[model samples]
Structure formats: structure tokens, C-alpha cells
Target: MVAQRSPVDLTDRRALLARQPDDPTVLAEAQRLKEVALLDFGIRDSVVASWLYTKCHHHIPTTAVETAAVVATGDGSCLLLYNPQFFVDIGLAGVRFVLFHEARHLMHRHLYAEQELRADPLFHLAAEVSINHVAMVRLQVTGLPSRVVPGKDAGTSHEPVGVDPREVHQRYADDLRDQGREPLSYEEFVDTDLVVYRELKRMRTPLVMPVGLCIHADHVGRHGSEFPADAETVGLIIGEALAEAIRAALRGNRLARDEVLNLIDRSEGGGDRLTRMWGNLGAAALRGETPRTRRVDWWKRWLADTLASKLREGERLVYPKKQGAVLLALGHDPMLSRRGRERTKVVLIALDTSGSMPDEVVDWVTTLVGQTDGVESHWLSFDGVVMPFVPGERVYGGGGTNFQNVVDYAEGRLAIDGVPFEVQPDAVIMVTDGYAPHVTPAQPDRWIWLITNGGDDWPEHHHPPMACHRVTTGDR
Candidate 1:
């Protein structure tokens, strides 16, 4: 874990960065790690033409992961240079935090939205002080799918982040070609109600609303997730408004001020915890003891314990399981085709028919069919003969087992069925007692050989990109 730091500003990075490291060796390692992170996220930063994005066809200069700051290209498609050394020196979690922070920039569409909102909404509320939380929330929700790059079939471009900040500058100039507009200063961004409401200034009294909110059914299926940051930002503003409204109601004799405060405190719990506090604040207000105005400190506590909790629970309504990348690809195209189109996915799982195998493995292999789990597992269990593992259009029943027939069957089907339909097999996971062939894929690009070494006849080539592993039926 990394020590949490104060909020940061990357734009004036020079002032933000206290010192710089100059070791060339450190810079090299930083660059390598940055490349791995980029690939893990599915970002392609190459000079080759993909027949995909036209703007990405040109040369992409080597990205420097060590610079505190660097240059950008004109088209917004190249990294040009960076100082990865700053990130490495900070430690990995620090790097992860920084990467996560930078990811928000790419995911939120902040560049474009900031330009539009600054030019429009800030004028509506004169002298506004923060980034427009309401607009930011709306944009993030609208753009979630667009930014995440669910899969190749999602049709979203896997563009490099900040190919060039200079392009951002150029875009700004182009957008301002009509000189009639004005950009809001950064001061207007940080001080606005967006920030103040979040921290709470108690311009009014707090409410007695319930501590808990209901969650959607779909949300329960996915993990309990926090609300989107932008949405949390909006919630703070609204919560502050609600607090002020409650104070108004009490002062106007709608309710006893102490009774309301008691209700709020009681909301922390119910039965006995709430029995005593209702007459405190409300009674004082009735006797004209104190005027209602914003109390920044009271709000700070309320916001963190109350409204802030709501913000964290925002995505409880999102239903992440249904919203993930798997379904996105299944529901769309280019990545999958039933008949014959572009690329086809063929799934083959190897089963060890060895004497050491257990019954549970057989049960699992049998039930997961019809491609419900997004795969048609071709299972081959080898005792001596190459018994058919995963029966395809070619067979209906499970038979004997043979180690060598596993590859033979796959190559045959791929050459036959795939050739006729013009599709290709992308993945093949072999779940077996590692007694099979020691041969590697001549066409290594199409296969992922995972040797589930049940009986310990270990195979050698199980390292990476091409994954190899052993799994017992007892251990998941």
C-alpha cells in the first residue's frame, strides 16, 4: 500500500514535482513497466496500420515513462515522451495510484467535457467555484461504455492516452475559433459549490433521513461497488441542499428543531439509541437561541459519515455482472460469427482420463455445454486410446481417451470446419494429467495450451502469454 497524499494537480507539474531522477537505467525499467501496463489495458501504441483507426496509422514515437512531463504529437495519437522514472522511484502502489488517477482522465472524457461546461454552465451560476458536478456526473454515466473498451467487438477505439497534450492545446484553439466565448479560470473550478457542498458548510441544519438506502436486485449479483466518483461529487451538492432545506422547515415551525436533530442522531440506530435526542437543536431554534446558517464543520462530519457513504454506494445500482465485457462481445460483432465472417472462437478443454482422475471432474466437464459459459469445450481424456474429449458436431457420446488424439482432433476440426466457414480458433485450454505431447504449436498464435497436470507427469513449456497450469478437482 502507498501513503495517501493530498490531492494533486498534474497541469502545473513543474511546481508539483519537487525533484527529478536522471539515471538512464531507472528510466529504461520504468518504460518497460509502463508498456506492460498499457498492454494489460488493451491499448495498442504501434506505428503499424490496423485498417482500424486512420489517425493511428502514422509513426508513434517511443514513449518515455520516466519524465515528470514530456511532449505530445499533433493528432492525439502518440505519447512522444514521458518520465517513467518519477513513477518507479515512488514504488509500485504509488505507480498504480498514479495510473488509476491518469486513467480517470482518459475514461471521463474530461478534456472535451471541461471545455464545453466551462464555456456554458459556469455562466449560469455567476462566479461558480468548482468543476460542474452535475454535468460531470451526467457525462460519466453517458460515456461509461464508450470509454471502457469492453472488447474488440465493442466498436470503441483503443486509443492511446495523451498521444500528445499539444493536440489538446490545438483542439482548444480550434474550438475557440469563435472568439465570442470565455473560459472559466481554474479558481472558479476548485472553490465552487461542488467542492464546498461535498465538505459541507452547514448553511442549514442536517436532516433525519434513514442511514440506509435500498439496492437493486442486479446490484447484489455484482460485488457491492462504490458510486462513480463524478456521481459522488453530485451527491455531495444535493445533500448539502437537503440539509439547508431541513433547517428552513424547522425555523418555519414545520417541526421541532430538537426533535429533528434527535431523529437524525437516532437514525444512527433505532430502538434505544434514538430515545433521547430529538429536543436538542429543534428546541433551541424554537426559543430563538441560534440563527440557522452554514456550519462548515458540522457538514464536514455529516458529509463524510452520511452523504459520502451514499456516494460510495452509488454503483450498487449498476449491475456489474451484466455490464461486463463478456456479454458486450456476445451481443455484438467482428469478434464472433455463427456461420462465416471474420474471427471465430473455438474452445477446447482437455480432460485427463488417467486412473488418478476423480469423479467431480467428470461431472463438471459434462454439465458445462451448449456454450453457455461462452465456450464449447472439446474434452479429450487419455487412458491409452485417444478417446473423444469434447464431442462436437462429429460425435454424441463420451468414449475412450488418448493423449496424442487431442491435437489431432483439434487440427482436424480447425482445418475442416474452420476452413469451410472461414473462421479461426482463438483459444484451447487443455485440462489433463500432463502426460500429453511435448510438442509446441507450429501455429503458436492460435492456441493457449494449459496442461492441468493431475498426475504430475509435468510438461516443460508452461510459462506465460501461453498459460500452463495444474488443477485438482478438489481445488478450484
Candidate 2:
């Protein structure tokens, strides 16, 4: 029989940590165990695990933690804490499982940094389930040692630890069947973190999370106010790390390549947010597709094609007497002039500026228009009235939206700040949320409407509809 350990005193954990450094041998053992865990990560070909482990500060803090836990430092690094005595009890395989488990928690936090999602208790349980499932499969562990019991022969039974995702899924499946509903397979049940949470919520009585199982439960609060640092930047860092791992794996590292490929397969089509996040990581290898195919943002491409068609040169060409030498050399007459052929297309870009447009969308539009050659760009930031401003200039707006004012300005029917748009524009592009009154433009064909996500798409359904496309601002 295994000897039962005394209840851990949470209050004295700090005092124990304060005296931890005094024990050199215990600290050395902890370091060795960490190295062994890294080796296991290598064996499993987990690039994310290896990268995350490198960024973590391993400490054998004499805390009451039964096994191990990882905590984000809010500065793009994490702390990996373990009890040295616990390592001796559970042995090497258990230590490897715990370390991998902790690393995955950090990745989960980085990937799904939304405050609302992280706050949901069901979501937290789902994350635990997903991480544990992946760890078990990758590490080839049928079970983990129990922390509640400890002795010379403790944890040798190989019984699974904590809340098993498969068992919970099975319980959910059984309940759904009783209700005459279909249950997801074990593979589908553990697809993504949110999928698990959403499916579990459908249950009449969702599984409750047992206490003292998840170590970082307290860290995720209702508002995520605990983590004040920029979560997006941290997420970007994690993405870059994944990209490097993928590249390393591609360079003949079989283990890393297989592990990352599995992660990619499991996380495919998670949602637009996840897609955008992974897109930035140069994750072509993950998708098993080329970069060209992935860069195809439908709306952006449509907008580009529309602009190209609108600004296309007229059939008429003027021959310049002085610059016709090149044309003459090509067996063409000197009558071919470059002056009229190179017609500068006039484009007026109007922003709604109702404090509803995303800054990222604005930046993307500005960059797109600024880079095009042979186009005269005119920028207008409008709320109730139109304000003509140069590109890259900041325009503050908090007033009501008025579509008529923008149309009037673009049509040369109005002037602002002694700047009159006397020249007829070849194309007028409007970026808005479609929350204002509908006004017909003088030339609706030349007008292109790019509506932001969640905006009213009135133009799309309008009688004699205008060119319109929804800009998918994924996760921005």
C-alpha cells in the first residue's frame, strides 16, 4: 500500500520558496528533470514545446503545487514552477507529462487571448481537456501518476490523472444519446478549445471542474484585468516562434515537423480569428499550401480588381512629337505619343470616420492607395461634413455619419476649407459601416463601397445595387 501524504498547507508556500535556494541538491535535481523533459519534447518532435520551454524560467520553488504549472509573466515570458520533492515521487515520465502540459497552457493562453472566452469556466475546462489529450497522445502515456497518494511504489499503477478529456466526452455522449441527440466522436470532441467548450455547453448538465486540478485557474479572471499587458503583441511573438519552429522542422527535423503538422490539422478552420493569427506566422507548412494561395483575401482582391477596371486607360492615345523615338524604333509611327496614353487616374477615397471603423482597416486602405502609380489620390475624412486631408494625416471624428455630404463632395457639388474638387474623379471609393442614410451617387458604377464587418450592408441590397464588398477584419 502507498503511504498517504499530509494535506498541503497553502499558506506556508511562500516561506518554503524563500528557503528553496538554500538546498543546492534539490535545485540541481529540478534542473536535471527540466532537461529530461526537454529531451522528451524533442523525442515527440514538438517544436512549440521546445520553443516555449526555452522562453520559460524553470524554478524549483518549494510551493504546495503537487506537480507543475506555468504562469505568463506579462512580458512575453513564462515561469515554470515545480516542487522538487514531487519530481522524485512521480519519476521522469510524469515530470515530462507535466512540463509539456504546462507549456501547452501558455500556448493556449497566447492563442485565445480574448477576455470573454478565457473567463468562461466551461472554456477553461475545455482548454484543460484539449491540452491533456494532446499531451497523452504525443507522450504515449496511457495514464499519469496520482498526486494525492505518495510512497516508494506511488504512481507506479499508471492510473490517469486529473480530468480525462475522453471520459468527460464519453459522459457527454451518453447524456446526449439519452436525450435523443447525436454526440460528437472523440476526435471531434477534442477538435479545438472553443469547440469543446461549445459542445459541452449543449449538455443539460455540463460537467463541473473539480478543484485543485487546474493550477492556473485563479489567473484567468472575469475581465482578464489580471493581465494588463498587450495580449496581441504576445500572441504575435508566439506566432513568430511557431514559424521558426516550422522552418526548423522543415530542415530535416522529423519530430518537430510531425508535431507541428498534427497541431495544424487539429486547429484547421477554427475560425477567422485563428486563421488570421496563423496566417501571420508564415504557416504554409501547417496548411500544406503555398503562400500565394493563403494571401488571397477575397474582399481585398475584389476591391483591387474593381479599382483596376475603373482606372483602366481610355482607348484614345496621344503621340508626343519629342518622345516618340522609342515608338518609332518598334516600327510604330511617331504619331504615338506618351502624353495622352499615360492618363493620370483621379481617385477619391472617403472614410466615414464615425469612430466605428477599425484602425487596421484604415491603415490597410491607406497603404493600398498610396502605393499605386499614375493615380492622383484625394483623401476625405467625413462624419457629418467632409474634411479633405492628406494621406497619413490623423483625422479625429466622433460625430454622426452623413453619406450625402461625402457624395456631394466627391461629385464636385461641395467644397471644404477652400479646396474644391473641380476635377471629375475616375473612381470614388467609400469605406464605411453602412449605418447612414442611403444616397445615390451621380455615377454609381464608379463608386465602390467597402463595408467593415458587422456593418449594415444596405448598398448590397439596394435597388440597382452599387459595387459593394464586406471587409472581413478578422480578429483585429
Candidate 3:
């Protein structure tokens, strides 16, 4: 069995948090509270959250946040920040609720990144409503955690508590009605997070503004801070976590199954990032058991995620101290400081281009590479010989397939059209029918093989196996 990692030491991670309380007692108490909440999750039926809490770094007594928030760190990992007094005031129940809410927020941010929806204050409110609604129902809490307000009852904050989805829906309905527009039913409104956002967009004025109440709302704009948390980094981290959760669920872990299902049901929507990741996950974990309607051609997603991992390996990314300080202060993830040349990641796509290869496959590859940011892509069409080409420009190759020629050109042993292939790619993707005799590249680990529908997957059975997946026309 693989050894489980020990929980990260908070002292080591505390440096990541800006403006941490100088008082050691306050820090220790906050750590105790955080540990208690995490322990509660472990003992309860929240394996996913428990696992996530263990995976993420945590900092206590952070003045950057009023309550708690999860932000991506500069190192492509996530950090949870919380105010010590807030946790102390809220008690254990509130601590649990807020932690769960922040966990859900991290998941939400990972799943969706639409600029328009993120920019809309209503959407942020809608997200809070949906997240809090789930947290309330799952945790069996009737009311939100409140802190003491001056001139009021000791556990009563005068600030509006807006956790209930139904209450938010009622307010939205009233506003829409006043504007002479129809409103969706509460059930319909709460179908999914995206659905809530879409319905909220119909309203002329939102009853609850999420600006000061939520961290995401406060840090939505650049305002001297470009969206921190490298999108790729967050995507990779969350994808791995979900993939692990899915594996645990599939292995008959009841709690894991329930949490995974809840996440997929509540957060997933058409054409979303999570949808693609889930498709690849379900396909891999469930194999042929996935339903037709939900079955997507997961190869593209699988390939994309695979390429990302391979390319990111062994790369040290850091941010400027000044910029990182500002990002941490705002509860935002700091991006790595890299020059334009250093920022560009190279990928090479080698198409078999034999008669067996389909047009759709090539088009899919073209679109995938073209859409990726900071990726300098090189294209090659290989038959018996290899020829360099660019996307959208057709190259003729009808001869027999030979994998060695492509590998030769990639490793700088062979030249194409008398010009030596000098660009060293971070990863190489070879799309072919896999009919040719397999020859090993110098670095087979850097290579990925895509076999066509009727093609053989020789790479998988090779002496040193390579990452190989079948390319389909579309969804099966």
C-alpha cells in the first residue's frame, strides 16, 4: 500500500500568510480550532472535505480575511486563511460551516472561470447562496454563524445573513416582479450554481450584494491585482483531488461516493471545465458503465490534463516578493514571475497523416493546441518521412506509417526538408493508428501516443510503456 502523507506543519506554512497575529497564543488557539474542525470532518461523513483540508495549507489569524477563505498559493497549491477571532466567536458548528463553505468556494472557483459570470456581482451572490445552501443542508444547520455585534445580543451580527437559497430566491422574485418580469421557482432556481446565476441575470436589481460578505466578490477585479491563482495550476490540483475522490468512491467508500455525487450534481453544467474533467474521470473510473447522455469523448480532456502534468514537471515557479505580498494580502493566489521567453511552454504534435487517420481528429488537435495559453506548439505530419507543418495548412502524407521517423525528428537525429528540427518541446503528442513497428524515443516518458479507432495501442504494451489512449471520432 502507498504511504499516506502526514498533515503539513502549520508553522512552516504560516509564513505564506501576511499580517499573521504576532501573539503566539492567538495563533495556537486558531490552530487548535482549525484542527478540531478538520477532525470533525474526518470523523463525520465528509471524506472529500477531510481529504481536501488535509491537502491544502492553512494559516490562522490572517487579517487578509474577515472569516475564512481558500486562495491558491504561488507554488500552484491552495491555502486556507481564517481569522482566529471569527473562529472563536462562531464556535465549532460555525467553524465547520465556514470551512465547508470555503471548501465549496474553492471547488466552485476551480470548476468555473467565465469572465462575465465572475464579474457579475449577482453571480457572486448566487454562488454564495448555492454554496451556503448546500453547506446548510449537508451540515444540518438552520442559521449561519454570527459574531457579536455592539448594542445587540451577544451572538447576533447586524449584517444581513444571506445563506438561505429560498430567502434569496424570494427576494429575487420580488425584485423581478417589481421589474415586470417573471421569476423561476425556488426549486428551479436552485437546480445548479450556473442555473442560479442565469436566473439572477434576469433580475434588474439584486436584493443581496455579495461584495463585502464574500472573498470572491471582493477580489473579482484586477484593481492592481490580475486574477491570481494560475488557472492551469488550480485546475491541475483540483482535478487530481477529484480524481482521487472518484477513485475512492468507486472503491465502495460510501461517504466518498455521496460527496462526489453531490459535488457533480450541484456544480456541473454544460460546457463547463468541471464537466470535461468529470467526463474524463467517469470514463476512466467507470469504464463502459457511463451513460450515453453523459458520455463525452474524454480523450481531449485526458490529453490536455496529461500534457499539463508532463510539461509542468520539475519546473520551479516563483513570484516577485512585492507582488506576492500584495496578492497574499488580498487573499489572491500569486502567479509565478517569469519573463516572456521563460513563460512560453513548448509542445509538439506529430500526426500520422496516413489514410487511416481521420480529419476530425486532426481538427480536434489543432483546436486544442491553439486554445492553450503560453504554449508554443509545433506541428508535424509523419508518413514514411516526417514533415513540419502548421495548423490550418494541409500537408500531404499517404505513405505507410512509421513511428520511428517522428521520434527521430523529435530527438534531433533527423532533419525535415533539409532544416534541422531544433526546438526541444516540453512534451510530444503523437497521433496515429499505431500500425507501424514501435520504436522507443530517447525519452519515452515525454511522449504521448493517440491511437485511432481501428488502430492498435502498441505503446501500452511496449517494453517501457508510454502514455497511450485511443482517439475517437467523438462520444461513443
- Model 3: CA > 4 A from native: 1-18, 22-25, 58-60, 110-112, 150-162, 176-182, 208-210, 220-223, 283-288, 291-476
lDDT (0-100) at residue 180 of candidate 1? 44
Clashes of each: 36, 4, 0
On lDDT, the stronger of 1 and 2 is: 2
Order of quality (lDDT): 3, 2, 1
lDDT of 1 by residue, 1-476 (tens): 11122222222234333333456676556655543433322222211111111111121212212222111222333221234544454433333223333322222223224344424322212111122222223122221111222366664444221112223223333444445444333333233333322222221222221111101101111122211123333223323323432443332424223323432432333323122221212223344443233332221222122222222222111223433356556762112111223222345555555544544544544554342333334554444444443453232223444555556555664233233213233455455556544545545434433334334434434431333333422211
lDDT, candidate 2, equals 0.68
Local distance difference test scores for all models: 0.32, 0.68, 0.69
lDDT of 2 by residue, 1-476 (tens): 11223234322335436645456786766766666566556445366776665544334466445566654445555455677866655567777777777677666663345778765777778888888888888888776545435453764443445678888899999989988899999998998777888899989887877665655654332243342224554465456457556655644577777777777777777666666655554355345653333444556655765676467434212235455567568874333212235578888999988867777777877787777777898888999889888876888687999999988888778878777789888889899998999988878878889998888888877866887888883332
Q: Model 1, stretches more than 4 Å misplaced?
A: 1-344, 365-377, 389-402, 413-424, 445-454, 457-465, 472-476
Q: State every prediction's TM-score relative to the real structure.
A: 0.28, 0.52, 0.55
